[model samples]
Target: MRQLIFFGWNFIFNADVSPLRHIPDTKRRHLVLQALGLMWAVSFGIALGSYTVLAISVLGHAVLIAAAAVTVATYTAAASKPHLFMSGLGRSRDGEHD
Candidate 1:
């Protein structure tokens, strides 16, 4: 069971970042980068649709744009400056807690 868990984790979280070691902060940066890209895409789609097929009201479109902007900005900052997401618990980004 433990091995299964470890394998799953490595497959999902450590697959790309393996060569860099399991730095949690670095992993977080990767995740945030992905999220930033996703949100940016979503925002683009919504903005485009708002101009054509989507029937969303002006206020709804504005709110969606605002949320997307916030998400992109937050994740971009986190991914760009990894230290901001550090655990700072005197331990590596591994599961061990010191």
Candidate 2:
């Protein structure tokens, strides 16, 4: 039990030894940090009865979800119809510069 507590403390306080380092993508790391910030915001809002903060955090979460959905849709569309999106960009269908 004591070892587990110490591990948790180290994980929270020691950035150099944290699990975030294992994530190779910078965007994913940023997303994780943003999520942690939102969790803290929600916790603070609930603890202090700040409905405004809670609303803002909820809005932020919604924005993130929307952005992710748009990104997925764009990728899917691009994959399905690469020519439609990539045309007039000085590149050919074979990815060669014109």
Candidate 3:
């Protein structure tokens, strides 16, 4: 809990707060990967014209279904990964850091 507040203050006050200073490099990489996955999910959801339509309609529809599945899976996985959560965000994981 304290760490979250500290992270935000550091962002405002300290220029030396290296982005990777708080988390391990490995975890930082995972965080970037997860963030990119989330962005991709948004793009896919936006570009795919009709959401209610099932993927069985056309051959290319399978791509939409696959993308949706990936997005859901990434969301699920992110829920378990604490580094993926922004510290200053209202949704702090409490003891759920992983």
List the candidate 3 regions with Cα displacement exceeding 4 Å.
1-24, 50-98
User: What total of clashing residue pairs does each candidate reach?
Assistant: 0, 0, 0
Model 3: lDDT of residue 12 = 42
Best by TM-score: 2
Structure candidate 3, residue pairs in collision: none
List lDDT for all candidates, in order.
0.72, 0.80, 0.68
State in Å the error of residue 93, model 1: 95
For residue 72, what is the lDDT in candidate 3? 93
TM-score for model 1? 0.30
Q: Which model, 1 or 2, shows the larger TM-score?
A: 2
User: Candidate 2: misplaced stretches above 4 Å?
Assistant: 1-48, 89-98
Please, what are the lDDT tens digits per residue for candidate 3 over residues 1-98? 99999999776434357454455576665576578669988889876845535444665777888999999988987888856656655654665652
Report the lDDT of model 3 for residue 97: 52
Top candidate when judged by lDDT against the true structure = 2
Q: Give per-residue CA lDDT, model 1, range 22-91, as digits (tens).
A: 5457667687667866998999999898776555576678899999999998899888987766756366
**Superposed Cα deviation of residue 81, candidate 3 (Å):** 75
Number of the candidate with higher TM-score, 2 or 3: 2
Q: Would you estimate the TM-scores of all the predictions?
A: 0.30, 0.39, 0.26
Query: What CA root-mean-square deviation does each model show from the true structure?
Result: 30.3, 22.1, 29.2
